[model samples]
Target chain A: MTELLKVTGLSRRFAGGGLFRKRKVFHAVSDVSFTLKRGQILGIVGESGCGKSTLARLVLRLIDASEGQVTFDGVDMASLPRRELRRLRQRMQLVFQDPYSAIDPRYSVRDALLEPFKVQGVKLGSPDEKVASLLDMVGLNTSLARSYPHQLSGGQKQRVGIARALALNPSLVVLDEPTASLDVSVQAQIVSLLERLRHELGLTYLFISHDLGLVRYFCDQVLVMYLGRVVEVMPSDAEPAHPYTRALLDSSFEPDPRQRRTITRLSGEVPSGYDLPAGCAFANRCPRVSDLCRGVLAPLSTLPNGQQVACHNPLIDAALPAACR
Target chain B: MLLTVDMLRIRFGAFSPVDQVTLGVDRGEILGVVGESGSGKSLTATAIMGLLPRIGGQVAGGSIRFDGTDLVDLPESQMRRLRGGRIALITQNPMTSLDPMMRIGPQIDQAARLHLGLGRSAARARSLDLMADLRIPDPASVYDLFPHQLSGGMKQRIVIAMALAGDPELLIADEPTTALDVTVQAQIVQILVDLVRQRGLGLILITHDMGVVAQACDRVAVMYCGRVVELARVDALFEHPRHPYTQALIRCIPRNGMARGTMTAIPGMVPTGMTQPPGCRFNPRCARVESRCRVDIPELLVGPSGNGVACHLAEAA
Candidate 1:
């Protein structure tokens, strides 16, 4: 597989406190590195404050990275000039988490979809024809083009968002919890739509969601994050390689009532970003933490199947042979 | 049974939010109410606890009997004493439920002192003991910290601790784990289950997730359009759902081993509050709808093995 997007040593920090006092720095994204292959979906799973959104914004250059490099299709995104960056926006797009807030209430669906083309100053033969095609592709009727955001349901509004993202035919789309706000039944519809669109258009995706079940069903590779750090990176075909990943998988309750298993609950709470601990960020809550794990930070180590994990222990038995342990 | 709701109807202005809903919780049973938003699950729980807002709602008809006493007819002063003493509610969003300016220890202690008649010192000591039982790290330190200082999971635990302060016979938890992560959700469910078992208390768990309902509930009640559409043993309901809405809901969830892009979704959105259809509210979305469903409402028909269903097909069968 050829790499479509490569990010190395990406970091973002913010300074706090008034100017009179020494400012305290908060590291939102800490030395994160990952690669997205062509036509592959990478799911970033984490809690609310784990900085997954910050990483997505950095990739889209909606916000700048404090340190590290981002290369997309042999071009350095961080080094691009304003004119070049604006041109690159046509090839990469973002779908926000909340469909209600992402779409403008004042604009009709047709105007929302045509804004991308209008911003690029592209004079197509007929904008209405393109808008109609986009709506049909996203499973919405062309007649809905004149409807306002409030006139559509949550699922319909999300479909409009997807249509707008594909208006410029972007190769890479970053989706942030596209189905979190809808009903379970409506969520199923949107997931199916997204899967079909990915295959039909040959689009790559960076899917960010906290729902583990949806992630397991949607992405080809999964990255588990905690406290602004990647804890595990596992291929979707294999079992997870870290204890935190296993805990997340085990915590998912089956819909059938007959199945029962003892759950190993992680103790304590996630530490605040303002006062992070020195060693492993998960040490306070990890059940398998050892003395070494508490005193030293773990680097990403590649496994047999080219999966990377960043834990001192790594739940090695679950990932590799005994000889490796 | 500790609590029984018989044909309870709650109305907001001219709209009937809860229409002839009937259910009950035994002394030591956890009855899970599963439904989507606008299904009136929360409103039903609030009505039973006498905590409904006075803006536009009233208990239009029927009765909520607790320990053979009707709660709907009780005075405000008398209902206030029974609320925290016999029935307690644990809301989903704990951050908003807790006061940010107050310390955890005093907030929990206050509940005990007010309802259980424990002295200030005794309540404070008991608060520490309850925190320890919940496996809160450094309970002594956490007791002095304010609400903003605690994490999401810790704040939830504090809410649960406060609910347990009065030693109530019934615990009404409304979407208690919806806002937490899956790992934290499992931990909280285990804690609630263990607490209920240890105290032999009745629990009413209201949530939208069918997975949580299957694992945590003994008996499951499927609510739709403000009515209990189906009520059965958890095993029975999962194996064979009688109502069309229940079947569609179960089929909609993506299971663990299922292939991607193969999930089946029920078409059409839920109807709004003001424009519910006359006969059967779910008729527009029901796949098995017939002409009879559009003109007449169905009563809860007792089916095999003590199951209750409110569908025309189930009633005929």
Candidate 2:
């Protein structure tokens, strides 16, 4: 498999609250690892505060990982020299969640597209020509070059964000809930645009979203996370093996009353991220939790169908622990 | 019908974003008003609540009737009495709905005391019962707790409890679960549905989620720009959506095991107030648009069964 990005045991810890020596480390992302194939969309699905966004930043090396490493194109990004890292950032771009705030209101569409080149200090043949092509690439009207962010719609602003990300022709683009704030119809338009861009550019995506339906529809493979831990990794078509994954899938209301799920919902608040359980982080709310599950960290076992699940009582017979230490 | 908003037109200064909105709500059922942003779904709810004046909006034309009473020009005093007593509103954000400093029970107690004229002890008794009915754990203890001490889901339950405290006959919840997580959203929706059935209250559930409409609503009104384009029974609406906007929206829902590229996006944006389309508001983005669609406004024709469609093509069909 041509893996564009391979993350191994990535962890990000935050010193929560209180200044000075009263240190309480919250593991924002712990023991998370996944592979994004070249030209493939690997979706990371979770609820709010599940570290999906934090993991995205960690993958792009926007923030340092407290533990483990991210190897991009078979190169350790952490070990790369500062100068090399800056050059490498061109190959790895990020699209923010809110299209409204992602772009500067001060910058016109033309200026926004050209800012990437200016930041990289790359001299183009014609900056205006480059702007036109980038806008055209994103299917925006060339005349919108003069319009500011306020003048553009939410979908248009998002198109500009995507165009900006593609300006440098990045191989890996980490989209962080890019359509969460958008209306449903506009979200569909953005998804279609992203898909087209991926096909045309042969780009790989690390799409982080809270919407399970959208992820299953758009992604090639799914990585379900609960409180900063990767609980399940399966192909989009596979039935989710993890209970947490199933809960997420059950969360979104299906558009048919006849198919409405009978009322067994995952109750209880998500445990504090810092004060996670001793054994499985999911044991508190896990429907299939047992004494063994509560007392021990679940091994991420791979099934025959290549679905990886980290649970003592996985819905599907899962994989052996891949190397937690 | 507990509530009927017929040919409702709302204006914000010179610009009217919502025009010709017509829908009905009966006791013991949920009537979902589903639409995107600027679709005037919320405006209709606000008009029903008689809070349009507070939001710089006015009922430009048409009428809102509740229990055979004309509510359009009802005096403020009567509207106030009707608001919390019979027409309670549950807004999207529960965090802001409750007073942070006040105890949860007292906040709920205020509704019962003001509307039902219950004494202090009686209001407290009623609040606890409402909280218990909402399935909140240890309602007795939770009644004494502050809003900040509660989780998002719990806080929303408290909001629902307060709405019920007033003993409302028609509950209008405008995107009540939009601020919450999907898991929490489902729970909240279930609570609302139960409230409708058990309490036998007419519910106007305003949301942008078609999925929620399918799951929670008995009947649904599909709005575009400022008008209800389609209104039908939940089963019939899902079985065969008539309006082009409604069809496009249904197609966009990512169904289970749905193949890639099957979700078709409606091209172009929903025209805002300033840029309202001349003919059918949806004609610009509609694939089946013809000369007739671009020249005249289609009237929302409700059939004998109360199913309605506002498209010229649907009329032709």
Candidate 3:
């Protein structure tokens, strides 16, 4: 598979403190590196304040990164000129969490779809025809184009949001918690729509969400983040070997009672981003934390079958799963 | 039964949001009220807490008996005494539910002071103990901190602490962990389940997540468009969901072994206040809907196993 995006050692640090006080440097996205192949969905799973959202922004160049390189389609996005970067934005798009807030209150469905084209400076053959076709592509009725966002259902509004993301025929879509606000049935519809669209349109997706079950089911590969670091990266179908990943998987409540598993409850809370520990960020909460784990940084190392894990003691052996091999 | 709600109907003026909902909770049991948005699960919970009037709702018809006391006709003064004393509510968003100006200690202590009628010192001690019970590290420090000062999980723990301070016989948690992350959500659910077991308090957990129901609840009531479509034990509900709505809900969630493109999406949107169907509310979206389902309203009927279903086709299942 051809590589669509390559990120190396990307990091973003935010400094906050009173004018005279000691400045606190928060390592939001610390030394994260990953590659996305064309037509592949890479899911980033993490809890709040884990910098999943920050990594998404850094990749799209929506926010400046403190360190590392973001090469999109072999072009370094950071060093690109302002005009060139704006032009490059047409190839990458984002769908935010809340459909209600992501869209303009005053703009109609047609206007919302058309707004993307106008901003991207892409001239369509016919704006009306394009808008209606966009609505149809996302499974919305053509008649609803004239309606405001408030008049539409949550699912319909999200369809509109998806349509707007696809307005410029972008190759990569960064969907940040797209289904988090919608109802489960609606979430199902949206997930199905995204899957179909990705296949039909040959699009790559960077799906950032807190829902582990959905990520495992939908993503081609999963990247588990903890406290601004990539703790585990595995094939979607493979069982994770990191304790943090296992804890996250165990934490998710499955719908089937027969498959009910006890949650490996992690003691203590997520540490403050500003005052992160000197060792591994997740050492305090890791079930297998030892003296060495608490004092030394755990390096992300590749296993035999290419699944990368960052832990002193991995759950599964290096003998890879058959499917992954 | 610690609390029994029989055919409880909640109406906002002419539009009824909760219609003919019947469910009960036993001491030390967690009854999950599961549904989507606008499914009226929250309304039913608030109705039980005698809080429907606050949201411009009234108990149109039905009986809410708390240990044999009919709460429907009870006067406001009497209801006020019952609320926060025997029945406490835990709302969805702790950030919004909690007062930003007040410290966590005072906010939690106030519940004990009012409901338990404890002295200032007693309330403080009780609140701190509740916080500790919730596994909030450094309860003493957290007591003095503001709501904003704590994390989302910490804030929710404080909310749970306040709810427990009343020593309520029934705790109504409406989407308690919806705002929390998965790891934190697990912690909160564990805390709630432990509380139910220890205190033997009847818990009405209102959530849109079937996963939570499977993990935490003893029994489950599936709601759709203001109606209890199915009610059964959590294990039975997942194993053999009778109602079409309940079946569809189970199919929609991404289970562990589910493959891509296998997660079925229930077609058609949930009916609203204006477009509500005359007969079976879920018939339009139900895959097993029959001709009779389109015109006849299904009553909540009990099966041989004591499980209930409100569907014309449920008899065959």
Candidate 3 to truth, TM: 0.96
Model 3: how far residue B249 lies from native, Å: 0.6
Ranking by lDDT: 3, 2, 1
DockQ of 2: 0.79
Q: Tens digit of lDDT per residue, candidate 3, span A60-111? A: 9999999999999999999899999999999999998876586679999888
Where model 2 places Cα greater than 4 Å from the true spot, the runs are A20-22, A317-325
lDDT tens digits by residue: candidate 1, B18-65 = 887888888788999999888889999999889765555789998999
How much lDDT does each candidate structure score? 0.86, 0.89, 0.89
DockQ of 3: 0.80
Candidate 1 C-alpha lDDT tens digits along A86-180: 99989999997676586668999988999888899888899899999999999998999999997888889999999999999999999998888
| Residue lDDT tens for model 2, B1-317 | 98899999998899888898989999998999999999989888889999999989999999999999999999999999998788898889897689999988899999899999999999998988888888898999998898989888899899888888889999999999998888888888988988888889999999999889988999999999999999999998998889989999988878888898889999999886698888898999999999988989999999889999999999533
Which pairs of residues clash in candidate 3, taking residues 3 or more apart in a chain or in different chains?
none
Model 1 chain A worst lDDT window (10 residues): A316-325
Model 1 accuracy (lDDT, Cα): 0.86
User: Measured against the native two-chain assembly using Cα atoms, what DockQ does each of the candidate structures obtain, in the order listed?
Assistant: 0.71, 0.79, 0.80
Error of 3 at A94 (Å): 1.2
- Model 3 lDDT on a 0 to 1 scale: 0.89
Candidate 1: TM-score, chain B only? 0.97
